[model samples]
Target: AQSVTQLDSHVSVSEGTPVLLRCNYSSSYSPSLFWYVQHPNKGLQLLLKYTSAATLVKGINGFEAEFKKSETSFHLTKPSAHMSDAAEYFCVVSLGSNDYKLSFGAGTTVTVRA
Candidate 1:
């Protein structure tokens, strides 16, 4: 089985400050990891993905996450925060099989304060 755990349910950041969202996972196989962002009433956009290829993966909007096999963690980070960065972020893991099922964490809602 493959599963992901997002440590923080919510995160607050001042405009232009750094943003960090923590996540951990456990998988039977080398699962694929992804970070997806969702704006209010908007669909999900892929921020980044790690597929047995890269350890440090960069995504859209100046966001990046490093896959640490030893710690079983993939934490998202951004050097600066913008008001537009306020949204829901989901940490996801793909069950590497034909089912193509995705397991999502509860999600972390980021609030950007001016």
Candidate 2:
């Protein structure tokens, strides 16, 4: 069985400060990991993905994550936080290709203090 755990339920940061959101996952096989952000009453936006390819993956909005197999972790980070970055983030794992079945971790809500 595969599952993901988000370390923080909520994170607060001042605008322009660095942001970090931790996630840990367990998989039976090589897993496709993703970070998705959801704004108030909106759909999810892909932050990044680890698809058995690159260890360090760069994403939109100055976000990035490193896939650490040994640590069984994929943590999202940003150089500076923006007020618009305030939202809910979910760590997800895909079971297989062509299958949209995604297992989502309990979300982490980011609060950006202006």
Task: Assess every candidate by TM-score.
Answer: 0.97, 0.95
lDDT of 2 by residue, 45-65 (tens): 998999988999999999999
- Per-residue lDDT for 1-114 in model 1, tens only? 899999999999999999999999999877899999999999999999999788999999999999999999999999999999999999999988798889999999999999
The lDDT for every candidate, in the order shown, is 0.96, 0.94
lDDT of 2 at 10: 99
Tell me how candidate 1 scores on lDDT. Answer: 0.96
Best candidate, lDDT: 1
Question: How much is 19 displaced in model 2, in angstroms?
Answer: 0.4
Summing lDDT over every window of 10 consecutive residues in candidate 1, give the lowest-scoring window: 94-103
lDDT of 1 at 27: 94
